[model samples]
Target: MGKLYGQPDRRPTAHPARPLVVDSQFSTTSVNNRVLVYQVPVNKKRPLLTISGIMSADFLPNVDPQQVMIGPAYAHPEAWVYLPLVNPSNLPRKMIVDLDHNRCDTLDAFLLRGQQRELVHLGTLFRRMPLVQRAIPVRAFALPFELAPHDSAGLLLRSRRSTGIHELTIALSTEKQFTIKRDEEESIRLVALSSAFFFMFTVFSLGLIFKHRLLIYFGLYVFPIGLGQLNYNYFFDAFPFPAWLGLNANSIGLFIIFATNCLFHTFGVAYIKSLNVYGRWHRYAVLFLVGANLIPMGLLLFPLTRTTNAMVTNASLILTTLNIGWLFYISMLGFRVKREKYLLITATLVFVPILYRTYVLDSPALSYSYFQPFYYLLLFGYLIVSLFRRELISQQMTEEKIRLVQGKLEMLRKSEIEQIGRNLHDQLGNTLASALGYLNLKEPRIQVARDMILDAINETRVISHNLVKDDNRPLDEKLEDLAERFNDFSTISFAYSDYTEKRINQLPLLKQQGIYLIVQEVLNNVVKHSQAKEVTIQAFLSEDVVRVSIEDDGIGYTPNQPTSGIGMANMYKRAELARLKLSIDGSVSGTSVTIETPLGG
Candidate 1:
């Protein structure tokens, strides 16, 4: 027989509402197959003892009466009943039975001999049953049984003592050996979805590291919402966790939703501000809300921390309201700023469904799954517009800088032309006039001297003409002119080939002049020092580049040998001005100077 204990009641004399009272009872029974079930019934509730029941061995219609024996009672009218049954004969036949709701609250089958009343708690249920006479404790709110001819006997459930109506129903059974477990399909799907979410989040994070704004925002704000939806569905539909964990499908969903929304708020502010739109007050509000949510998240990590469930719920509701309000505010601001109407409209449309699902509608049809993809799409559209705006602004700035530089270059070019004209008029003209005057004097002995003076005047005239003419022309034409003039002094042979005429025609004037001057210097060196039989000038033009090679089969000088000369230095300076790549190779066979320039066009 079970005993009962009473404790002093503490309560206010007058109460605003009626208090609920609970009464509970326990009994046990054993069937022929060595199965024991201790059934407890709490005051008449259909969902009995709140602890899941255990299976009996005989495949009885109800809790077996013969194997049951009464044990001790606890402090609050709680009772313990024991039922013991062995294996072997208990199996080979699957049994289905239903228990009376009013009598049996919960059933706990156990193998231990000692009874401890203090062990019974509201949230914990314990059961012990034997499999092939081997005892094991099963702890859960509910348990399913599959007993075979050769299998061991095990307890089906453990129940906490409580006053409620508990009814038992056999959920499933099969003659064929249990091949596949229940919830397996749903578990696999949930895992697959979780893995996908993890991958997408990782990708988003990497994109953020690289400063990809679209992917960053997508991962930060959008992907989490999808993950939240998946979590909500997964927890509710399959693989339900412990109630003590305080992580229900709804709680996880709300947490993810609020957190992701907070991120969106932050990113949105920055995104708008970058577009020269103001979002100051909204940003501050979002920051405050984010702080509030973070406190709850921190608290959740510790084991057995008293959950501020109401606070978390309230915070979630507030955040959702604030997010909706901010969305509307941003839409108004977008209108004032004349932002992209389609993007604004799309965002508004997307938000409407989420808002409706969250607040106005309770149906699963209005779930987050329907709206998440659309939200990401709207975000992508906004990102594209932002990128286009940035690119346009950058292009305008570049154009302005180019125009300023072009103006300065034009001024410099005009000044250079004016300076060159003055130098020619003041110096070369005076020298040529004096030479002409000397040539005009008549005398037989002085005639030879006069001829020499006339030749000098002619040479000076040609030089003056070249100095004044536009230096922009084909490099070959310039080099050919130099070779012709040099031929007047010494016999010159030129061999030029393997270059496209079309490319030569496209050389910029400045680059052409630089190459011409370099060739002229090389020819002058050949005349002054190299007693050569032939000279070879080759010019080649490739896409966006020009190469000129001038070679003479004459005495070559080693570059390492010391010399006091400005000719090579001047050639290098001309190359720098034209931005030409120059290389000179000299050997006993010949000396070759190669000048290369990249065509700007």
Candidate 2:
């Protein structure tokens, strides 16, 4: 017998119960005619290169191709199967050859003619076979072949470079059987794609409604993710575009996938850390991860080749490790800052499976099977629900704040009415009574009674003016004017001083008015009850707050005692309403009332 190429000079032996033969040689050819052609020694270390038993159309589907060991013998990055098939029929027949591997990049076949004991290639049966040879998304390449009686041919199945594990499976069937199988598989893929799209749409709609950028980022991320998955699963084989666009669909799809994926991570980290929840080191680490993720995308700019593909794969593996480590690190930091815990947990939980499916199990950072799209759908659902919950919580908090403000306003209104009533009765009623008593005296002192009646009228005017005072003036001017009015009312010497005049004037108009009212009430108490000979109004700044203090050299009362004075009570209530702090310190020499207001508020 003639010696075959890369085979021992002996007749190829067939199994007793099977018609399959072994040539003790294997070769993998690239589309550009680059070959990693080598021979596998017929020893225990060599894996089964060909299937045993009768190679019939019915039995081909059940034949499982052994895995190509990726050791020193087959160390090249690019690999595929070079299976030899024999025609076992006496009658000439036409058959459809199908290579069913989702991760396959290309598939082709060529006829083999026998010369002595060797098999030689005749001509190309097909080259760079289309992935979608059918009308649907079934990931199989089917080609029609005509075989003479007892003639043989070899099927060439080419797959992308295997970074870790690799396997191949082949099927031979009639044209009708291939159509039926393709249709059946197409239905399953369609359902998966539809479900993935539904989730994507739901997430995008929620993002539009809420206008949350986190959800929007996620929605955009899913688009390229779906494309990358389709590309990885050989869906792009049927619609191969020319490289005139600088990059084909495969490379472009992968580029977008990694780019968008990195953007998602960057944006997510930014959104969560927008409040400055994490520290500078965490941000620096994130920047490093971003740079690492970007390196792989830059590598895609090179032409798609075995070496370039391997480089991209190694870079992606590094990125995957960095991403996983970064997630765990961020999760650790998330525990320290409670606000980000939910976000960290959700992201880590959702992305763990996705990264595993994309990088660890399937292709790294590029392609995935049909099942991977649904993982994105799951992530989308999580983001939508989280945003809704946050919105609901924010709405509830706003409503609660409004209700509390209303209640405070009601209390302030009633307190003001009582204070006014007390002032009227205490000042006007007493003056009128004194005047009547003097006029009804036996001597009828008309001049003295007239003076008393005039005093009562003046008191009424003062009360009316205090009820509606002009508030457009600056706060320091208002304070000085108040002190002047109080000095006119009583013999208590009034002095106005402002050390932080600019700061006081910068306060909001509402706050200035509130401070003015509080000071008026405090001085009123000093005139009516304290019998103070001197009073000083002072304004100053204290640690992030503005303080207005009214000190009187009056008979001070006990601090804890419940006073019946409406002026003191109203002062406290007004301070509470204005969101200011009020404190009164009384000593044997004097009483000091201070109103402390936040500078920012």
Candidate 3:
């Protein structure tokens, strides 16, 4: 139990303990297990420190401890350094580990101290860190070390580095200041909370509204994007799903993100009310995005080789960059077509920081600081914009419907006025003229004048009754009247067939009105243009749908041939407002028009 200080003047005893097994879960091979112990002498004197820079990886397997003290230092790409310290006083000690690697790939620190059971456990000197936007962290760290029989035990630290020329600073001190904590990581919880809020907002918007296509697609897109942040930010580390979801979780998140990108591009190009604006080129771009999204599946099938890694990297780089470029292009299109400047600007402002955070400054650890405020705010903006657009489109549809309904009412008023004008000009005027003739002829025929007066009175009563009535006339009665009035010496006959009483009354009021107007226009077309001798109107109900059709036996024109008169346009517009599907078929033999509408509450 004799001890030597300042250096390892005593080789390890035969009963000395071996080093503990280093945990390497993902590694393919085993490591050499050799433990070295050194004893430092106690002194009320100044502290001691020893520092060395490693020049090559070869130095680790075979090392001359004496030669290591005298080796010349040269500036090189990667250095594995050995730093040892001896605390020789009967008090607590402190150490600082300062590393600077601008082009860093990986840094592993092993801090070893001796134990009675024949193994040494490494102290966690530094948490796992990944280079984010900043190439190098601008801070250093101070850590505490304690040992039993406090004065004479030493600590050993081995650092392996893989980077260009860099510096390492290890110091032994008696102070209590540690500067390893970063200000950015402190608010990690806040960022996570913000992400959660945005994520829930997207879900709420999706569940609340289905009136717009943008909302549906945008909601779907937000799902993978938000979860990807949580997953990459290490939020899932505490969750049980990651045990089974490991690796596959990341893979699936990436797949969904890619698919959402494709969907967003597609929906962005051709969304509600803007379907006519997206052309063949836009469709082709959407197809290209879909193909791009499928690239991640390749990782599942192949054992990754150098070529596969290169391919995957290229695909990811291309698609990720293209997502931004595609959005910019859409913004330009939106400005021209929809004047959606806020949509583009807010999106760009919101997403640019996200791009920097995601693509530039990704950390290996799920540190709270990994979640950025801009990413969450950007997502919130998207949700707001989607809902805003949905609301605008809904209002537009409602107003259009109101305008169409107003037109229908106006058309109904005009028809009634025209019929009243015809009755007064022909029937009532003729009867009054006959009464005047009975008096002017000097016949003094009181009974004949009385008869004419009664007829005139009845005509006035019918006109007044038709004008004041608000209830609907039966379809059959209206058709009979239309036939009698338009019968030019029996030149044309009206044939009408309708659904049963139960089904007919089940039709909505607006739907019935639309059908009646549409039929009236069809009969008028037959009279004015078809030279038709017979016109037939039919209606029926089938499978929760109500259908109305009109047919004529005369010369017929093609259906939807743009040159059709204003009456046809009115019928088409009315049918649209009523949510009815309309079609017309015309040929030399005859013409037929039909409309079908769903029954609704």
The number of the candidate with the highest TM-score is 2
Least accurate 10 contiguous residues by lDDT in model 1: 18-27
The local distance difference test score of each candidate is: 0.48, 0.58, 0.50
lDDT for residue 514 in candidate 1, whole number 0-100: 67
Give one digit per residue, the lDDT tens place, for model 2 in 423-502. Answer: 68986898899999998999999999999898787677567657764768888998898888766766679999998857
TM-score of each: 0.34, 0.55, 0.45
User: Candidate 1, overall lDDT?
Assistant: 0.48
A best-first ranking of the candidates according to their lDDT comes to: 2, 3, 1
Instruction: Give the clash count for each candidate.
Output: 25, 0, 3
* Each candidate: RMSD: 22.9, 11.5, 17.3
Between the candidate structures 2 and 3, which one is better when assessed by lDDT? Answer: 2
lDDT of 3 by residue, 417-466 (tens): 77568778777999999888887776678789889988787667555544
Q: What lDDT score is found at residue 584 in candidate 1? A: 85
lDDT of 1 at 412: 45
Candidate maximizing lDDT: 2
